[model samples]
Target: MQIVFVGGSTGQGGSPRLYRDELSGDFIVQGYLVTDPSDLAQMKIPDGESVVRVPRSLFDYLPKDDADGVA
Candidate 1:
Protein backbone atom coordinates (compact mmCIF):
# COMPACT_ATOMS: atom_id res chain seq x y z
CA MET A 1 0.00 0.00 0.00
CA GLN A 2 3.02 2.25 -0.26
CA ILE A 3 2.05 5.49 -2.01
CA VAL A 4 4.36 8.01 -3.65
CA PHE A 5 3.66 11.52 -4.79
CA VAL A 6 4.09 11.76 -8.54
CA GLY A 7 3.11 15.12 -10.06
CA GLY A 8 0.15 17.36 -10.81
CA SER A 9 -1.33 19.85 -13.22
CA THR A 10 -0.75 23.59 -12.83
CA GLY A 11 -4.19 24.70 -13.89
CA GLN A 12 -5.86 28.02 -13.11
CA GLY A 13 -7.77 27.52 -9.87
CA GLY A 14 -5.41 25.12 -8.12
CA SER A 15 -3.16 22.23 -8.96
CA PRO A 16 -4.30 18.74 -8.15
CA ARG A 17 -1.78 16.37 -6.61
CA LEU A 18 -1.01 13.00 -8.13
CA TYR A 19 0.18 9.85 -6.42
CA ARG A 20 1.22 6.36 -7.44
CA ASP A 21 1.01 3.12 -5.57
CA GLU A 22 4.37 1.37 -5.59
CA LEU A 23 2.78 -2.01 -4.98
CA SER A 24 -0.29 -1.88 -7.22
CA GLY A 25 0.79 0.61 -9.85
CA ASP A 26 -2.43 2.51 -9.29
CA PHE A 27 -2.79 6.24 -9.73
CA ILE A 28 -4.44 8.60 -7.24
CA VAL A 29 -5.41 12.18 -7.82
CA GLN A 30 -6.57 14.73 -5.28
CA GLY A 31 -8.66 17.68 -6.45
CA TYR A 32 -11.42 18.56 -8.87
CA LEU A 33 -13.41 16.00 -10.89
CA VAL A 34 -12.64 12.72 -9.20
CA THR A 35 -12.48 13.18 -5.45
CA ASP A 36 -12.78 9.63 -4.20
CA PRO A 37 -12.11 6.02 -5.19
CA SER A 38 -15.82 5.26 -5.02
CA ASP A 39 -16.34 7.92 -7.68
CA LEU A 40 -14.71 5.57 -10.17
CA ALA A 41 -16.60 2.49 -9.14
CA GLN A 42 -19.28 3.39 -11.65
CA MET A 43 -16.66 3.68 -14.38
CA LYS A 44 -16.23 -0.10 -14.24
CA ILE A 45 -12.44 -0.08 -14.31
CA PRO A 46 -10.62 -3.38 -14.74
CA ASP A 47 -10.81 -5.87 -11.90
CA GLY A 48 -7.62 -4.71 -10.20
CA GLU A 49 -7.38 -1.24 -11.70
CA SER A 50 -7.63 1.58 -9.17
CA VAL A 51 -8.01 5.34 -9.44
CA VAL A 52 -8.41 6.86 -6.00
CA ARG A 53 -8.09 10.08 -4.05
CA VAL A 54 -5.94 10.84 -1.04
CA PRO A 55 -5.55 13.73 1.37
CA ARG A 56 -3.50 16.71 0.22
CA SER A 57 -1.41 16.18 3.34
CA LEU A 58 -0.06 13.05 1.74
CA PHE A 59 2.36 15.35 -0.03
CA ASP A 60 4.10 15.83 3.27
CA TYR A 61 4.78 12.13 3.53
CA LEU A 62 7.12 12.03 0.56
CA PRO A 63 10.71 11.04 1.22
CA LYS A 64 13.05 13.93 1.92
CA ASP A 65 15.09 13.25 -1.22
CA ASP A 66 11.96 13.01 -3.34
CA ALA A 67 10.64 16.22 -1.84
CA ASP A 68 13.89 17.97 -2.70
CA GLY A 69 13.64 16.73 -6.25
CA VAL A 70 10.19 18.29 -6.58
CA ALA A 71 11.39 21.63 -5.31
Candidate 2:
Protein backbone atom coordinates (compact mmCIF):
# COMPACT_ATOMS: atom_id res chain seq x y z
CA MET A 1 0.00 0.00 0.00
CA GLN A 2 2.88 2.33 -0.67
CA ILE A 3 2.06 5.60 -2.42
CA VAL A 4 4.51 7.85 -4.26
CA PHE A 5 4.20 11.46 -5.20
CA VAL A 6 3.35 12.17 -8.81
CA GLY A 7 2.88 15.95 -8.92
CA GLY A 8 1.36 18.99 -7.26
CA SER A 9 -0.07 22.39 -8.06
CA THR A 10 1.67 25.62 -7.09
CA GLY A 11 -1.43 27.50 -6.19
CA GLN A 12 -1.22 29.94 -3.33
CA GLY A 13 -2.91 29.13 -0.02
CA GLY A 14 -3.92 25.70 -1.21
CA SER A 15 -2.18 22.82 -2.91
CA PRO A 16 -3.58 20.08 -5.13
CA ARG A 17 -1.39 17.02 -5.32
CA LEU A 18 -1.33 13.74 -7.16
CA TYR A 19 -0.03 10.39 -6.03
CA ARG A 20 0.47 6.97 -7.48
CA ASP A 21 -0.14 3.69 -5.71
CA GLU A 22 2.97 1.59 -6.17
CA LEU A 23 1.30 -1.76 -5.78
CA SER A 24 -2.05 -1.19 -7.51
CA GLY A 25 -0.82 1.19 -10.24
CA ASP A 26 -3.67 3.56 -9.43
CA PHE A 27 -3.73 7.33 -9.16
CA ILE A 28 -4.72 9.20 -6.02
CA VAL A 29 -5.48 12.91 -6.16
CA GLN A 30 -5.60 15.42 -3.36
CA GLY A 31 -7.52 18.61 -3.98
CA TYR A 32 -10.27 20.88 -2.74
CA LEU A 33 -13.48 19.11 -1.96
CA VAL A 34 -16.35 19.87 -4.30
CA THR A 35 -18.96 21.36 -2.04
CA ASP A 36 -20.94 23.44 -4.48
CA PRO A 37 -24.45 22.10 -4.45
CA SER A 38 -25.14 23.12 -8.04
CA ASP A 39 -22.00 21.39 -9.25
CA LEU A 40 -22.68 18.23 -7.32
CA ALA A 41 -26.27 18.13 -8.47
CA GLN A 42 -25.22 17.58 -12.06
CA MET A 43 -23.38 14.37 -11.27
CA LYS A 44 -24.80 11.17 -9.83
CA ILE A 45 -22.28 10.55 -7.11
CA PRO A 46 -22.35 7.19 -5.47
CA ASP A 47 -22.34 6.62 -1.74
CA GLY A 48 -18.69 5.68 -1.55
CA GLU A 49 -17.38 8.06 -4.25
CA SER A 50 -16.65 11.76 -4.16
CA VAL A 51 -14.90 14.36 -6.30
CA VAL A 52 -12.20 16.96 -5.93
CA ARG A 53 -11.03 19.90 -7.99
CA VAL A 54 -7.45 20.24 -9.14
CA PRO A 55 -5.50 22.38 -11.57
CA ARG A 56 -5.11 20.97 -15.05
CA SER A 57 -1.43 21.67 -14.95
CA LEU A 58 -1.05 19.00 -12.30
CA PHE A 59 -1.49 16.39 -15.01
CA ASP A 60 1.44 17.76 -16.95
CA TYR A 61 3.76 15.88 -14.66
CA LEU A 62 2.13 12.54 -15.34
CA PRO A 63 4.49 10.00 -16.83
CA LYS A 64 4.07 9.84 -20.57
CA ASP A 65 5.20 6.25 -20.86
CA ASP A 66 5.00 3.04 -18.88
CA ALA A 67 8.67 2.38 -19.29
CA ASP A 68 9.10 1.90 -15.58
CA GLY A 69 6.40 -0.78 -15.68
CA VAL A 70 4.54 0.92 -12.84
CA ALA A 71 1.43 1.35 -14.92
Candidate 3:
Protein backbone atom coordinates (compact mmCIF):
# COMPACT_ATOMS: atom_id res chain seq x y z
CA MET A 1 0.00 0.00 0.00
CA GLN A 2 1.16 3.53 -0.73
CA ILE A 3 1.97 5.51 2.44
CA VAL A 4 2.16 9.22 3.13
CA PHE A 5 3.46 11.16 6.07
CA VAL A 6 0.57 13.30 7.24
CA GLY A 7 2.30 15.48 9.84
CA GLY A 8 5.08 15.67 12.45
CA SER A 9 8.80 16.25 11.73
CA THR A 10 11.43 13.81 10.53
CA GLY A 11 14.22 15.89 12.04
CA GLN A 12 13.14 14.84 15.50
CA GLY A 13 15.52 11.93 14.94
CA GLY A 14 14.37 8.99 17.09
CA SER A 15 10.96 10.60 17.58
CA PRO A 16 8.26 8.37 16.06
CA ARG A 17 6.80 9.48 12.71
CA LEU A 18 3.14 9.01 11.69
CA TYR A 19 2.17 7.52 8.32
CA ARG A 20 -1.09 7.22 6.34
CA ASP A 21 -1.91 4.74 3.64
CA GLU A 22 -2.47 6.56 0.36
CA LEU A 23 -4.75 3.80 -0.89
CA SER A 24 -6.73 2.78 2.23
CA GLY A 25 -6.18 6.07 4.10
CA ASP A 26 -5.49 4.03 7.18
CA PHE A 27 -3.12 5.58 9.69
CA ILE A 28 -0.28 3.41 10.97
CA VAL A 29 2.61 3.74 13.37
CA GLN A 30 5.28 1.12 14.11
CA GLY A 31 2.98 -1.17 12.01
CA TYR A 32 -0.12 -2.66 13.67
CA LEU A 33 -2.89 -0.31 14.78
CA VAL A 34 -4.21 2.13 12.18
CA THR A 35 -3.32 5.66 13.30
CA ASP A 36 -1.96 8.65 11.07
CA PRO A 37 0.84 10.03 8.27
CA SER A 38 5.62 10.30 7.44
CA ASP A 39 9.02 10.80 5.86
CA LEU A 40 9.53 8.70 2.72
CA ALA A 41 13.10 7.48 3.14
CA GLN A 42 12.83 6.40 6.76
CA MET A 43 9.41 4.75 6.60
CA LYS A 44 8.67 1.05 6.44
CA ILE A 45 5.36 -0.47 5.36
CA PRO A 46 3.84 -2.16 8.35
CA ASP A 47 3.34 -5.92 8.17
CA GLY A 48 1.37 -8.56 10.11
CA GLU A 49 -1.19 -7.93 12.93
CA SER A 50 1.18 -7.52 15.82
CA VAL A 51 0.90 -4.22 17.72
CA VAL A 52 4.06 -2.31 18.45
CA ARG A 53 4.84 0.34 21.03
CA VAL A 54 4.18 3.82 19.69
CA PRO A 55 4.46 7.24 21.25
CA ARG A 56 1.01 8.48 22.27
CA SER A 57 2.12 12.07 21.87
CA LEU A 58 2.29 11.56 18.08
CA PHE A 59 -1.50 11.51 17.92
CA ASP A 60 -1.61 15.14 19.01
CA TYR A 61 0.26 16.14 15.87
CA LEU A 62 -2.16 14.49 13.44
CA PRO A 63 -4.53 16.66 11.44
CA LYS A 64 -7.90 17.19 13.06
CA ASP A 65 -9.62 16.24 9.80
CA ASP A 66 -8.24 12.72 10.06
CA ALA A 67 -10.12 11.97 13.25
CA ASP A 68 -12.76 9.23 13.07
CA GLY A 69 -15.66 11.05 14.78
CA VAL A 70 -15.03 14.64 15.80
CA ALA A 71 -18.08 16.15 14.17
Candidate 4:
Protein backbone atom coordinates (compact mmCIF):
# COMPACT_ATOMS: atom_id res chain seq x y z
CA MET A 1 0.00 0.00 0.00
CA GLN A 2 1.18 3.48 -0.78
CA ILE A 3 0.51 6.53 1.36
CA VAL A 4 -0.48 9.57 -0.68
CA PHE A 5 -0.90 13.13 0.55
CA VAL A 6 -3.58 15.43 -0.86
CA GLY A 7 -2.70 19.07 -0.50
CA GLY A 8 -4.79 22.19 -0.18
CA SER A 9 -3.51 24.88 -2.53
CA THR A 10 -0.84 22.89 -4.33
CA GLY A 11 1.91 23.79 -1.91
CA GLN A 12 3.05 22.50 1.51
CA GLY A 13 0.41 21.08 3.77
CA GLY A 14 -2.16 18.72 2.28
CA SER A 15 -5.86 19.38 2.33
CA PRO A 16 -7.60 17.49 5.08
CA ARG A 17 -8.29 13.88 4.20
CA LEU A 18 -11.74 13.06 2.90
CA TYR A 19 -13.52 9.99 4.12
CA ARG A 20 -15.45 7.86 1.64
CA ASP A 21 -18.81 9.51 2.23
CA GLU A 22 -17.46 12.96 2.91
CA LEU A 23 -16.65 13.59 -0.68
CA SER A 24 -19.60 14.55 -2.80
CA GLY A 25 -17.56 13.81 -5.84
CA ASP A 26 -15.93 10.39 -6.00
CA PHE A 27 -14.93 8.31 -2.99
CA ILE A 28 -15.67 4.71 -3.92
CA VAL A 29 -11.92 4.56 -4.46
CA GLN A 30 -11.09 6.07 -1.10
CA GLY A 31 -8.91 4.24 1.35
CA TYR A 32 -9.50 6.47 4.34
CA LEU A 33 -7.90 5.99 7.75
CA VAL A 34 -9.65 3.95 10.40
CA THR A 35 -7.07 4.04 13.15
CA ASP A 36 -6.91 5.78 16.49
CA PRO A 37 -6.22 9.53 16.39
CA SER A 38 -3.22 9.19 18.68
CA ASP A 39 -1.87 6.32 16.66
CA LEU A 40 -2.46 8.19 13.43
CA ALA A 41 -0.45 11.03 14.94
CA GLN A 42 2.46 8.67 15.39
CA MET A 43 2.82 8.83 11.64
CA LYS A 44 5.19 11.71 12.35
CA ILE A 45 3.38 14.04 10.01
CA PRO A 46 3.79 17.67 10.97
CA ASP A 47 0.88 19.46 12.55
CA GLY A 48 -1.73 20.95 10.15
CA GLU A 49 -0.68 18.35 7.65
CA SER A 50 -3.20 16.25 5.74
CA VAL A 51 -2.58 13.08 3.75
CA VAL A 52 -4.17 10.01 2.26
CA ARG A 53 -2.60 7.02 3.99
CA VAL A 54 -2.96 3.63 2.33
CA PRO A 55 -2.53 0.28 3.96
CA ARG A 56 -1.97 -3.27 2.71
CA SER A 57 -5.51 -3.52 1.50
CA LEU A 58 -8.95 -1.91 1.57
CA PHE A 59 -10.54 -5.32 1.39
CA ASP A 60 -12.02 -4.86 4.84
CA TYR A 61 -11.99 -1.31 6.00
CA LEU A 62 -14.48 1.49 5.63
CA PRO A 63 -14.32 4.89 7.31
CA LYS A 64 -17.11 7.31 8.15
CA ASP A 65 -17.23 10.86 6.87
CA ASP A 66 -15.55 13.55 8.97
CA ALA A 67 -16.99 16.46 7.09
CA ASP A 68 -19.96 18.37 8.37
CA GLY A 69 -22.65 19.64 5.98
CA VAL A 70 -20.96 23.01 6.10
CA ALA A 71 -20.83 24.14 2.56
Candidate with best TM-score: 2
**Model number with the top lDDT:** 2
Q: Rate residue 49 of model 1 by lDDT.
A: 56
Model 4: per-residue Cα lDDT over 4-68, one tens digit each: 33222223443333333343433433334546788776777777765455544442233334364
Using TM-score as the measure, name the better of candidate 1 and candidate 3: 3
Off by over 4 Å in 3: 8-15, 31-48, 66-71
* Residue pairs in collision within model 1: none
The TM-score-based order of candidates, best leading, equals 2, 3, 1, 4
lDDT at position 35, candidate 4 = 61
Rank candidates, lDDT, best first.
Answer: 2, 1, 3, 4
Give me the displacement of residue 56 in model 1, in angstroms. 19
lDDT digits (tens) for residues 1-71 of candidate 1: 99886765554525467677777766566665554556775687777555554456646644455443332
| Runs of candidate 2 exceeding 4 Å displacement | 11-14, 67-71
Model 3, span 1-71: residue lDDT tens = 99876555445544467778877767767423534443323556556533455667777766686366121
* Model 1 CA deviation exceeding 4 Å by range: 9-15, 33-71
TM-score of 1: 0.37
Please report how far candidate 4 places residue 55 from its true position, in Å: 3.8
| Clashes, model 3 | 8
**Global lDDT for candidate 1?**
0.60
